[model samples]
Target chain A: MDELSLLRRIRSEVDGPERAALDRGRAALLERAGAEAGIDARAGQGVRGTRVRGMGPDAAAAVAKRRHPVRWVGLGALGAGVLTVALVATNVLGFAGWRGGAEPAAADALQAAALAAVENSDPVVAPGQYLLVETDAVYGNTTNTEAGDYVSYLTINRDKLYVPADRSDDWVWVRSFREPYASFNAEGEALAQKSYDEEVAEADGVPELLRAPDAQFYGNSTVPDFDALPRDPQQLLNYIYKVTAGGGNSADGAALGWIADTLRTGVAPADVRAALYEAAAGIPGVEITEQVANLEGSTGISIGRVESADNSRQDLIIDTQTGALIGERRVELTDEGWGFPAGTTTGFTAVRTSVVDSAPEGGTQNGQFDREGCVDKGNGNFQC
Target chain B: MSTDNEIIERSLHSAGAFAEVFDRHARTVHRYAARRLDAGAADDVMSETFLVAFERRAAFDGSADALPWLLGIATNLIKKHARLEARAWKGLVASDLGRVDIDAIEQAAARLDASATARRIGGALRRLPAGDRDALLLYAWGDLDYEGVASALGVPVGTVRSRLNRARRTLRIAIDPGAARDEEVDHGRIVSASPDSL
Candidate 1:
């Protein structure tokens, strides 16, 4: 190969900083910009003094109506749990006006899903029973070559979490990576095979056990009492904004993403799930992104909001028949930075929650084991 | 649809407009930084690069694109952590040697060959003069042409060409000295000129 290609290949394995890092950088820049614009980001009220560059009268009016000041902090304020839950709010607020409101078809689909959720039985974890949550996910993975440039492949993963009926009880998670589903280029295919081969050769493809404080997916704090959250869709959205303050890119996107996060845990009650769907219906820029979106072989309707800044769409897939949240998927609207064509699925996850009799056994594979879910009672009584 | 120059100019009046610039180039800057430094340092460099660019936007030369300007800023910030970058390169070279196990696996053989070449290139990159390295990487890793490299380095195109030629010779020899001698004789002389205008 030519020296130029060789030089490019040197240290080419490194892709861009992760989504969180890019957001942090953007947040830092915008915060400085907000300071320069004389906006009180902390107060969250800067409508009167704001001067939105290149925006015409109507666009500026929409900004004023929202009363959303430019935020300086990146999604860091949301903390890791909420950030993980929201999956990074696509499309900060100011850009939503350009996309207009939710499509009628999209609104109708969400409303239907809401009604279906209400009709379903309430989800409850009975005593002595464990909540088993399984998710299969496929997303893009990029690797650089010694020949210069980088290639992206579809990485597959499966995670199983067993949550006990008691909040304080131990939780066990099994995480595993599978072979690649596809690749954007030849190099990516080779790299994916190499990765899969190495994984199989080293660990014998055993799923590693993950122990945590609780079985909350994405490290979200304890699941909220669905009955406690406001039932009214508008009030619930407002509560979401208040709770997720200084986090995410835009208020609408964050609200929608907050709903996605809450539902994906596979624990929200029927009423709460219905309310979240109704809340999502009101979000501007909401649309039916995909009619037959498939996740782990399950097909569903993909409803999403676009983060216009980067042209990425964050989708929440809902099974219309059952009103159940199938999973979440992220799509690239345009091939700008990502080396894939438009409509490429950048990220995806399919969740399945069920009640089981007992939790799985744990070993000293990744770390110290706690006696395979055995519990100690008074007088050294052990139940294994 | 606004040109990067237009966006930067607009950002002067409406401070929030600067975010468009960040959206457009932050990843590119971060990727470049990551290639040169560790992930943590790369994040800092990416953040700092845009902050510095925003602060100095008033002095921007109104170029049609902002990537060259942003990368120039990132290159300077990376220079501040030269020691860390050198150490990373040294580590990569060391790791390459440690992988020469006689475990006869055909699957890993091709990767090993490529990895060894990459390590050699990394070592050679560390040894190159700082100016030449910057000029070469800006052109190679940055995907910038001769003029883009010149603009990123704030040097004349002529200087960029010379540095690139010198850097290429060093890399060729590092990758394979025997092939380098024959290739250099066959090709007459190395040139940095690309199809893009300088």
Candidate 2:
């Protein structure tokens, strides 16, 4: 059949809005229309947020959450104005058409990984069990001194998140940090050592544990509905493009990074993971960067996209055999920006997820987990 | 039986008169919004579209039919949640199996093919450029003609035609790759030849 008729037939399946929805909309409209006409709309209404602007209650509740800036892990606020990248590096118009000149190797590998994900079932977190995710990461930490020169070093972070199957139950998080190595010269090394010493001293007697009491499916408010995510590969890519719009140097790079970040949570269901892999296959410039990649001992194939702006590449390593995201890494392709040599690993994270019976003790006992304003860092520290 | 222009004009003086416009077109606006986003978001969009239209009723362009203008407003509102709309389309593409309505024998044929065709169309719709997608959807789902689409998108009639052509061409390719590849290639040469001629 022709495309237009096909589209019509497809859309014909969508039932119109329910009567209640129409009534709610009409009521809201009438309330506002009345108020604007100098009529009082406040008769018999017990107490509600002033609908002077006609905002529904849900919109009102979403306002606070929406005001909090959306943060993508591992990709801090990337400034704009780097719009011109290779056609393959941006998802704006590239790869929108059927695989027009995109590397086939990456797409093939990702498709295979997606199929593997569907075959392997997700770990069922039965009632009374906690899904424990342990992650170890190394990130570049830099601090500028009064003298104008900056000291750069790699900081090591290790954290374990214990999420009960019952979302309302208490969730525990424990984290620890240590400096592994400092690069960029003698002065940078000395400064890194000093900073680490101070952090250790300050954290003395401060337990690196936090507890969230009765969090409604922790991170639901922050994380979009994973189950509701589009499962089709092309549509999933479109969805990712929408979420990661204007995020990083390259939109495609940011999307790949976001997938790695979401997977690092270790909470995404198997179907979502499969969809994510399938979606990643649709991104241009996503290629098998490494055939046999090893991160912290675990081995997997590394799929990566290079950011043309900074000459850095973000790599997500996936075990094609099992469809598991083993690790993620950022490699500085050139020394132009960070003065790091080519192939220098600027940052990397290794993830391990398992179901645990209990959470470790010594956290802030019964500290109510605050979802407003503070982010639920898998690492115990909640950065506001 | 007052014209939409008359209702909107009178709504300026009598605020309650605006409800007539809502009563007349709320279902249409809601359906269009539901087609773009989900029903949940459609409620907000429907209510807010009317609210915006009511607040700006003084600016009504005195058309007999307010659907084009109302849809224009709705298109803008839908742009804000373009991501969610794409997700919704993706959802349709991913799960379109048991939703087909097979009532009769002829429809059964279409119904059997509906699942695959729906997925292909859904994928094509999401991938179309936002402007092209909007124009095509306004034409297809909103049941707007060329002039009506132009009015809704606030674009020239020629632009709407060209966008529909481009969008339909893409969808055509997605639905029947073997057949449309030659057409796309021929069109590509013509497009590239224009630069050379210049």
Evaluate fnat for each of the predicted models and list the values in order: 0.58, 0.56
Query: Model 2 misses residue A69 by how many Å?
Result: 15
Over the stretch B1-198, how does candidate 2's per-residue lDDT look in tens digits? 679998798666445557768878988988888878987898889889998898788888899999999999999999999889989777775234334545677775775466566677778889889999998888877888777888888887778868988998888887777764436332211121122222
User: How many residue pairs collide in each prediction?
Assistant: 5, 0
Q: List, residue by residue over B54-88, the lDDT tens digit for candidate 1.
A: 98998998989889889999999998999999987
Candidate 2 wrongly placed segments (more than 4 Å): A1-102, A182-184, A205-207, A213-224, A337-339, A362-384, B1-198
TM-score list, all predictions: 0.50, 0.47
lDDT of each: 0.66, 0.65
Best by TM-score: 1
How many residue pairs of model 2 clash at the backbone? 0
Encode model 2's per-residue lDDT on A105-202: one tens digit a residue: 98788888888988987787898889887877766644434553334566566767787897667777775645556477776678657756764564
Query: What are the DockQ scores of the candidates, in order?
Result: 0.24, 0.20
Candidate 2 chain A weakest lDDT stretch, 10 residues: A39-48
User: Can you give the lDDT of residue A360 in candidate 2?
Assistant: 76
